[model samples]
Target: MLIGVPKEIKTHEYRVGMTPASVREAVHHGHEVLVETGAGAGIGAHDDAYRAAGARIARDAAEVFANAEMIVKVKEPQANERAMLREGQILFTYLHLAPDPDQTRDLLKAGVVAIAYETVTAPDGSLPLLAPMSQVAGRMSVQAAAHCLEKEQGGMGILPGGVPGVKPARFCIIGGGVVGENAAAMAIGLGADVVIIEKSVPRMQQLHRIFGHAVNTVYSTRLTIEEEVLAADVVICGVLIPGAAAPKLISRDMVRRMKPGSVIVDVAIDQGGCAETSMPTTHAEPTYVVDDVVHYCVANMPGAVARTSTYALNNATLPHILAIADKGWRQALAEDEHLLHGLNVAYGHITHEAVARSLNMPWTDPHTFVRD
Candidate 1:
């Protein structure tokens, strides 16, 4: 099988799909890998590195796309890249299709086997492919929230870890999943008052056990979320419902109740957002003010730290890529139930029920696409 790795073209996106190590793995498996020139440069990976790993370097994305059977990417395919897609091509990437009708339509029309990273579950019901980036984004959320809390950034001029005479900032994390846990851990480490809102009792107990007296855990309800949001100096929205759009736990009206200059870093912005005011921002211009509240909603937050993100993401996605390359998409999906969950669209059909319901499109059972 021939695999293509294209440079990410999304605005301020600097992460590529694969690394030199990943290329070497494919090459070792007797698969041909074509990498776009400078595809890994943003992630500190050079052409010579890929060449050393036995990967052919293509001058442009067109050549890689034109020659490869499977295209591996970090983000969703941009408009131009989508136009270049061939029917029945395999697109393995983070396709957050629930919030974007246009992207959903384009993927369906292209007739590509669209496998979403966020939907690829593990045996334990954890999102394996999405975890690496989520870990990066979750940690970065605290960093971004701290920066946005400075006065120059139009924040309250409070320090996250205050001086001897002053109190540290308060952090409210929505959700108790990976992102929230990481953010809360960081915030607690910085001596900030951290509260995590969780819906699951077992998860909340786990969080309590993990943090003990270092942080507070709240059972997420409308009243509790509102109270926490109003009191928090830094609000990190990390709630996610897997492939579906993240629930809006913080409303516009709730924003009004927040302290002036409070910062919101919505880690779930990729799956829409948990905060109502969040729209996609870029790394170049990562923040916008809403009712004097700072919002850091860069859709690709992990991309800001491209090198770490690239290696981490590749580590998680490489095995799945190999599976699809070794076995055809149909065979791979038929063999692995978890991999089948990753298939959002295939051959002009909506194979993922969540995406179909989100876009109000007709759904075809994914099993229909698997032929014995």
Candidate 2:
């Protein structure tokens, strides 16, 4: 199998699909790797490093895309990249298709076999490939909120961890999953008052057992969310519905009512955000003001820490990549039920139910394409 690694083209996205170590592993398995020149520059791995790892460096993305059987990328293909996709070519990356109709339409028209990392599942029903980036994003959300709280950043000039005599800033996280848990950990470490609003009873109990008195766990309700948002100095929306678009739990009216200078870090922005005011921002301009409240909705928060994020992502995705490379994608997905869940589009059809339903499109089961 010949695999291609293209430099991520998304604005502010610096992570690469494969690392030098990943290329070496693939080469050892008798697979050839063609990486675009400078693809690993963001992670401090240069062309020489890839060459040393037995990957041939292509002069441009066009050559790599034209020759490789499978294209491994960190983000979804941009317009130009999508145009270069040929029928039956395998694309393994984070599509986030539920909210992006343009990308989904392009992908369907391209007839490429798209496997989304964000939708890939593990035996325990956890998203393995998406977990590392989620962890990074969760941890970064607090850091971003703290920055947004500075008076220079148009915030209330409040310190996350106040002085000995002053009260600490309050952080309200809107989910108790991996993102919410990691956010709570970081907020607590900063000595902030933390509260997590969750719908799952077992998960809330789990959070309580983990944090004890360090954090507050509340059952999610319309009233509870409103109260939390109004009282919070910073609200971190970490809600997720897997392959579907994130539910809008925080309304525009809610944003208007929040205290002036409050900040919202919508970590679920990739799935279209949990707040009505949330729109995809970039690392270049990460926040905007809405009714005197700050909203940080960077779609690729992990990209801000490219080195750590790249290594973490490669650690989780390498095994799956190897599986797809060693056994053809059809065989690989047929053998692993969890991996099959990653299939979003194939032969011009939407294969993921959640993504299709979210977009009001028809879905075809992934099993229809798997051969015995």
Candidate 3:
């Protein structure tokens, strides 16, 4: 099998799909790996490193995409890249198709096998490939929120952790999954009054145990979310529904209710965002003010720290990439139920239920295609 890794072209997305170590693994398994030149440079990995690991360096993305059977990428194919996709090419990446009708249509038109990392679920119902990046985005949410809270950034001029005799900022985190947990940890560490709104009772209980007095766990409700969000100096939107679009928990009207100069970091923006005002922003211009509330919705938050994100993502995705490369998608999906769930679109058919429902497309059961 020939695998390709292209440099991320999204604005401020510096993370590459495959690291040098990941390339070495593929090479060891007798699979040819092609990495586009400077693909790993943003992640502090040079072409020489990939070459040292037995990967062939292509001068351009076209060469890498044109030659490989499977293209492993950090982000979904942008408009330009999607145009180059050919029939039967396997695109394994974070394809958040639920929110983007254009991208979904393009994938079907191209007839490529689109395996989404976020949809891949383990037996324990955990997204292995999405977890590492989610953790990174969750942590970055706080940093972004903090930065936006500075007076110069048009925030309330409140410090996250207030000094003696000063009140600490209030942070409200929506959801209690990986993103929420990490956000809570960061907010609490900064001495802010952290409140987590979670729908799952058991998860809330676990959060109560883990955080004790450091964080407050609330049973999420319309009133609760509205009240807490309005009171928060910084609100982190981290709600996720696997392959589906994130629920719009915060309404446009609600944005007007929040205090002026409040900061909102919608970590769920990749899935269309939980905040009604959330529009995909780039790191070049990461924030926009709506109703005097600053919204930081950089879709690829983890990409800002490419080196850390690359190594962290490789740690989780390499094993699955190797499995797919060695066994082939059919064999790999047939053998691993977890990997099978990741298959979103294959041969112009939507295999993931959530993606199909979200996009109003016909759904095909994954089991029918990957039956052992």
Candidate 4:
């Protein structure tokens, strides 16, 4: 198998699909890797490093896309990259197709076998591939909110961890999953008053056990969300519905009623945000005022810490990449039911049910394409 690693093209996105170490492993497995020149620059791994790892460096993305059987990327293909995709070519990356009709349409039109890292599952029903980045994003959300709280950044000028006599900022996290948990950890570490709103009884109990008196766990309800939003100095929207678009738990009216100078870090922005006013922002301009509240909705928060993000993501994704490379995607997916869940589109059909339903497209079971 010949695999291609292309430099991520998304604005402010710096992570690469494969690291030098990943290329070495693939090469050891008798797979040839073609990496775009400077693809690993963000992670401090240069062309020489890839060459030393047995990967041939391509002069441009066009050459990598044209020659490799499988294209490994950190982010979804941009318009030009999508145009270069050929039928039957495998695209393994984060394709937030549920909210992006243009991307879904392009993938279908290209007829490529699209495997989304975010939708890939583990044996325990956890999103293994998505976890690392979620962890990074969750931690970063607090950091971003703290910065956004500065008066110059349109915030309330309150400190996350207040001075001797002042009260610390209040943080409301909308989900108790990996993102929410990590955010809570960071916020609690900063001595901020934290509240996590969760729907799952078991998960809420687990959060209580983990945080104890450090944080509050509330049962998720419309009234609760509204109340929390109004009182919070910073609201971190970490809600997720797997491959589907994130539910809008915070409405525009809710945003308007929130205290002035409050900040919202919508960590779920990648799956579409949990807030009605949330729109994708870039690190270049990561925030905007919405009814006197600030929103930090960068779609690729992990990209800001490219080196750590790349290594963490590669750790989770390398085994799956090797599996598909060694066995072929069809055979590998057929053998591993969890891997099959990662299939979003193949042969012009939507293979993931949640993504299909979100896009109002017909869903085809992934099994239909993995059969021997």
- lDDT (0-100) at residue 266 of candidate 1? 91
TM-scores of the models, in the given order?
A: 0.98, 0.99, 0.99, 0.99
Over the stretch 5-33, how does candidate 2's per-residue lDDT look in tens digits? Answer: 99998898899999999999999999999
Q: Which regions of candidate 4 are displaced past 4 Å? A: none
* Clash count of each predicted structure: 0, 0, 0, 0
Compute the lDDT of residue 211 as modeled in candidate 4: 87
What is the C-alpha lDDT profile of model 3 across 34-72, one tens digit per residue? 999999999789999999999999999999889999999
Runs of candidate 3 with Cα error greater than 4 angstroms are none
Cα lDDT tens digits for candidate 1, 1-372: 999999899988999998999999998988999999999999888999999999999999999989989999999999999999989999999999989889988988899989999998999999999888888898999999989999999899998989899999999999899998889888887889899999999998899899998988898889999999999999999888877888888899999888999999998888899888999999989999999999999999988899999988888988988888888788999999999999999999988988888778899999898867
Model 2 misplaced regions, further than 4 Å: none
lDDT of 4 by residue, 44-133 (tens): 999999999999999999999999999999999999999999999999999999999999999999999999999999888899999999
Positional deviation of residue 25's Cα in model 2 after best superposition, in angstroms: 0.5
Q: Between candidates 2 and 3, name the one with more favorable TM-score.
A: 2
User: Judged by lDDT against the true structure, how good is candidate 3?
Assistant: 0.93
Candidate 4 backbone collisions, by pair: none
Model 1 residue 39 CA deviation (Å) reads 0.2
Question: Cα-based RMSD of the predictions, in order?
Answer: 0.9, 0.6, 0.8, 0.6
When 1 and 2 are scored with lDDT, the better candidate is 2
Relative to the true structure, candidate 4 reaches a TM of 0.99
